[model samples]
Target: MAGDRDWWFDEAAGPLIRPYAMTRGRTRPGAPNLNLVTQIRASRNRSDLSQLTPEHQEIVDLCERPLSVAEIAAYLNIPLVVAKILISDLLELGDVVAGAPFQTSDIVDTKFLQAVLDGIRRI
Candidate 1:
């Protein structure tokens, strides 16, 4: 009877591998500072990647150009949490580097605000 069962589900069936399976059920990144705006880029060292899973290797390739964590998630077609986990693994392996996000002081700078206002007023 098992052999006779339908092999495929309907078109709406979800991905074969759940996100948790990809990250081995890791919900938190080892590096806690990786926020949505944090920029990620490939490291120059170029360590051996044969030990990494395909997803991990793909992430390294994706980060050749600096990209925000949110952009990495969008590019990988994975959840934000999963992207973080993958990036954390890459970080531990020294395959990539994460750039700090803008500080609150930079966002609140009076000069930057005035520039924005001036540009808006010109339009």
Candidate 2:
């Protein structure tokens, strides 16, 4: 019951639950609304949270401040796929709002040519 490879067991003959099992081995997100950079914020309709497992609840609590799937995964120390699946559940249940994928828009440097020239002269 407490071994490294053990599964969750309630009864001696009860069905075993794996650690990584998500929505019964589901590989697809319910809404397909998430990406690495997609931002998620908690919604007002957390009524669905009552039916969630602890892991799901943790996700909701963490998203009180908007966060991305990758961040969630890192924070929870779980696989990205698992975080995505849980987030998808929250998305389908209307417990979370998914923003468009975040895009980095930093300006490029204008001094690259000067830097290159400096390096060439040093060489």
Candidate 3:
């Protein structure tokens, strides 16, 4: 019955492969265009995708509607860096397009912060 259970996750079986192994210990991709919120889209011409690994194709399929790198990572249950590497690979293969997200930065208001602090002190 011990053999009946899945061995992929069994540490004693020596069958577990670390997620970073697929990336060959690469923490950062060579691509500089990738960011957490950058959108990815399947290219109109996906012929290049045929030469890629099935995993890459799956990633492309997920990007058919333009999902951000973070969304892809969350949906696939993979690390953010892994998703970036995948996206970078797809970009190199011309199978995916990277789109810029709207840039916005929060401006802190000192008066609002003080008022919130005062309200909290009263409570």
Candidate maximizing lDDT: 1
Model 2, C-alpha of 97: deviation from truth (Å): 0.7
* TM-score for each candidate, following the candidate numbering: 0.73, 0.64, 0.64
What range of 10 consecutive residues in model 1 has the weakest lDDT sum? 1-10
Query: Any residue pairs clashing in model 2, and if so which?
Result: none
For candidate 2, lDDT tens digit of each residue in 1-123?
A: 134223444546432554357456876667676789898899987765678986688788888998988998887656777788888888878888899754433326548756878999999
Model 3: how far is 82 from its true place, Å?
Answer: 0.6
Predictions: Cα RMSD each? 8.0, 8.0, 8.1
Residue-level lDDT of model 3, residues 1-123, one tens digit each, is 234324444655443656677566888876887888898999987766567764577789888898999998876556888888878888887889998874433436778778888999999
Off-target runs (Cα >4 Å) in candidate 1 are: 1-14, 102-119
> In candidate 1, what are the lDDT values of residues 1-123, reduced to their tens digit?
222222421336634567898899989999999999999999998679998876788789888898999998886667999999999999988999998765656586788888989999999
Evaluate residue 106 in candidate 3 and report its C-alpha lDDT on the 0 to 100 scale.
43
lDDT, residue 111, model 2: 81
TM-score top scorer: 1
All models: lDDT?
0.83, 0.75, 0.76
TM-score for candidate 3: 0.64
